[model samples]
Target: MFRNRDRSAETPAHETALACLEAGIAATLPERVVADRIALDEETIAVGGATYSLDTFDRLVVLGGGKAAGGLAAALADRLGSRLDDGCVVTTDVESGSVGPIEVREGDHPTPTERNVEATRTILDRAEAATAETLVLALVTGGASALLCAPAAGLALSDLQATTDALLASGASIDEINAVRKHCSAIKGGQLARAAAPAPVVTLAISDVVGDDPAVIGSGPTVPDGSTFGDALAVLDRYDLRETIPDPVVDRLERGVDGELEETPDAGARAVAAAADDWHSLANGRTAIDAARGVARERGYEPLVLSSRFAGEAGEVGRVHASVAAEIVAAGEPVEPPAVVLSGGEVTVTVDGDGTGGPNQEFALAAAIELAESGADAVLASVDTDGIDGPTDAAGAIVDRGTVPRDEVDPARRALAANDVYDDLDDRSALLRTGYTGTNVNDLRVLVVPAAD
Candidate 1:
């Protein structure tokens, strides 16, 4: 699946890291996850061990949004075939080929657009149309929050845009960022389930957020939201973004806090509890990290899964990973040489410089600098599982001792300082561009170290 398959073919360590990455990406394909977890058996549909009798429902409508919605819809179409009456899904990708009566609508990502609002409006309409006899199969996945944007009352798309910009640039955690989103949007934070109330709503989710909280994944359109407007306001204040955020957003949040605006349906809300089913996480970061570990072990390396819940600043994470790799090389501790270290989680980047790079790119860049400084013959491979890291086209990058010559370390450091890791990695032919992988599970990172000669 790697377009530049031979980019790291010369180095055994790099080859192992790249192979592990491929294994991870392949494990979480939306169709594959759906096939493994969802099954249709005549009057019965089983999702993640929960079986629903099809005889009870006169109609089955598929509704949801995300990066993997199209693929998930296609898989469901094949499984359900003619049983699917109507469906609509919003996604960031172009309308790729879909099956059955499901319609795929395009939307923007990392930021919501007017088109996203329209698409999400249609999705809400479909949800609201669900009758008592209708079974709503909702596909929730990563990127759904942005793709399924429907502004709350008194809020415009531009308001959402400005608020999103401020929150994203605030270096907040995903939970914190999504807390604000859940409160501001019309359909998010269990509103979709509320719309489909009185109808059974079954959700199959591909988790991209840490902790796999249904409320956080895609901002929990189907499940109940535990976050409140107060939480959103606290997030803004935590990031010191209260003053800079759009006035409308601040007003909305303040109104919500003051009980002037309605809050998102909490976990105990009847609408949320009535229409929602036992949420299923079809795939997640652990799924990718486990598959990668298997590949690493198969390649004769002792694989150490550092953590599937790794978080924090990308650069700091990178340096910590580098330190672990150097330890393996220096003292043969933590399983010795010929070891592959792996982790899967989302990292943050406090973009101080107007440079082009995402968290994974920054992670790789920082790791490269650390390895070079320590004179460690280690290789690092980091990539967003969805194939797009941050705002850049490059999925991520690979770095080894040769990625930067000893004399050029200064320039690499400068690039890292400027958050311009993309240009540096691109100049050295290290960026990995795999296009859309039809799935997302946060990020996959691998650090490989070989024995000294």
Candidate 2:
């Protein structure tokens, strides 16, 4: 029997399999893979052969929120050393051993809370206090939208909360949800950067959004935003969220739309186009592919890297990949046997059934059902790099032909509901958990298509 209690098959390379899964995940996160790629030394922060003087600023303050922000800040503090002034960062993971002069606070993810609002206010205050001589190193990573929350002016907590809930439940994509959220918040949509004008803002981005749009990544807290109140209203309209919004939310958005308030900083605006601002990308989805390719070479398998920017509905994406992997496992057509198919990107869950799993979980679960129903010979794992997927603590899940047993699963029924895979993979002890990785690139998935016997 395998290490699993009810294991039907055992591979001598299970440890290697687990290592590949972990490495693939680590490769996606920027902070984990970027330190070596960029010159982050004690004296300066350098990228692309250009160096920024670290000691020129009178005070160095780090402020941001995300699943990876804590770890990334810690790495920066480690690199900055004595140059770093008092620093505070909020993240889902509370890592204690950060570089130095930095404070870590835990925040909720995938959903905002009263504490999230309060913590964000604190971060804003820190940003606002920065002077011309101060250098603000903004570490914006994945999960930031929920980790840091602040309602826009005249918007109450209840209003923001209600609007967010409705938008998420309405099958809206992240881009759409963020458009609404950026308008509804004070810190998002480049408002954070505008808040700390004259003070140099160097943004270190670990992009989880597709196409790597800075304005959409964590709603562009430290970068300039192009999203407007009109765009936000359009998102709400496109999703038919007008009638569903709370009265207070409708009123607040109406006020903004009527020019009663200023919109988030516009792109190409003079203030945002200044040389005082610096933006550098540490890593992204491609890093995961690189990591998987190296592992594939070591494991003696041909590695085929699909797209790193795969998106759309999570369950549907899983079905497509599962079908391809199944064909390779059974018939050995596309790439051959003993091959691994690797993909990395962020996927969305529309929240119809309000199931507990995230995009990765939904993908794994959907794939599991597909494998189980078809009796495929493939092994697979799907995991979020930050170790938390959706509302649940598990980053993601793993599966094979032994997922739910052949004659058992109601395949069409489960995938119809979003992320119901958590229910099935939970029984197999395949849920991957690593707490918080401190860095996030997005989701990483690997499939093992063993040779046909």
Candidate 3:
């Protein structure tokens, strides 16, 4: 639920956009997603389209980390009840809580910390303790790359922390950032599956990445890694971050490229082959997008789902969305007026300025400027499905034609250029704050264009 929904609901268009956002987020909550995808029939348990016989394993334990892992673990624990022998999961402090028999641990995100390393050590220990009779249920989801940290040999936790910070600020795609992270970590890229070898690992994932590649989600701790050390080094080169990042990180990758370090486990690797058939993606951006589309239809608006795999710079994407709105208002080209455009995907910010704001905030601010310039009577709302945009507590922002004051247009442009749209949006009462919504399916954006008068 949006905490500031009432305050932001300035018009009918604002309310419709907010409703669509709420529907999208609610559809992906762990309780709803888990209940919809997982079911128990006596000794047989079904997850997605795959069924597992609980009678086959002597013990069943849960292990993994992510922003949504805590909620997923709690939902799964309730479903499995006494069948779940023991479990442990690391998540953001906001999502940490009691989960029956599962122990919930807190860790930082976007940047890993000493606490993350310690919590990850516990997860790896649990994985290493698994035997042939143990069945591990891995709850790998968004933010897992940061929540489950393990420094590779010859590297310290500080090395990882510094490298992670640099890569995130580089505006690299999640896949690229995660590719580098997998190579630097000891528990990523199917390494956790290797640690829990001989025990069948069933990965239940909530995908936040584009295309929903299992190898990229949570850096693929429970699946084979398709990325190599060479690939990671290339990512740094592409961003020109090799010289600026931690020295040890570059050295480690260079060594791996030279065969000094072993690569992450691949598809042919024994660990991956053992549990390759058990990985399941229970929810993703499409799950949320579909729900939002249904809400749009019910509200008497023709819904146009652009894509659930959008990427690139956030501001540019916002401008494009605004352009579409302008066209619809001008000539009703796309689907006529009273249309809602819905899209879902993860967007990146290059972080050229010292000001604080996430991709969603940047998107909304950019769209506001474009909407004002085009004189389109519409409303746009964009938010991270997890209810936290970037490092800020505000989920995102909602903007209308009047959002940018006519006289302050120049100041608004300056704020956006400085990446300081958070305060600007706040001053306009356009920010949407909902705390942590206990789920993450990347970002959801809605553009509501009412009938032209």
Using lDDT as the measure, the top candidate is: 3
lDDT tens per residue, model 3, 1-453: 888578888788999999999999999989998888888755987877878899999998999999899989889888888888888899984545558778888889878998889888988999999999999999998999999999998889988888988988999999899899999999999999999998889999999999998989899998988899999999999999978888999999999999998999998998776666799988999999999999999999999998898898999999999999999998897878799999999888998889989999999999999988888999999999988999899999999879996778899889888989899999989999998888889999999999877
By TM-score, the candidates rank as: 3, 1, 2
What lDDT score belongs to each candidate, Candidate 1 first? Answer: 0.88, 0.74, 0.90
Count of backbone collisions within predicted model 2: 1
Q: Which sections of candidate 3 miss by over 4 Å? A: 93-97
| Candidate 2, residue 404: lDDT | 65
TM-score of each: 0.98, 0.91, 0.98
Indicate the TM-score of model 2: 0.91
Q: What is candidate 1's lDDT per residue for 24-45, written digit by digit as tens? A: 9999998788777777866888
TM-score of model 3 vs. true structure: 0.98
Task: Please give the lDDT score for candidate 1.
Answer: 0.88
Q: Residue 419 deviation, candidate 1, in Å?
A: 1.5
Clashing pairs in 3: none
Identify the runs in model 1 with alpha carbons over 4 angstroms from their true place. Answer: 96-98, 274-277
- Candidate 2, 263-310: lDDT as tens digits: 777766554554224776677767766787788768888888867888
Measured by TM-score, how close is model 1 to the native structure?
Answer: 0.98
lDDT of 3: 0.90
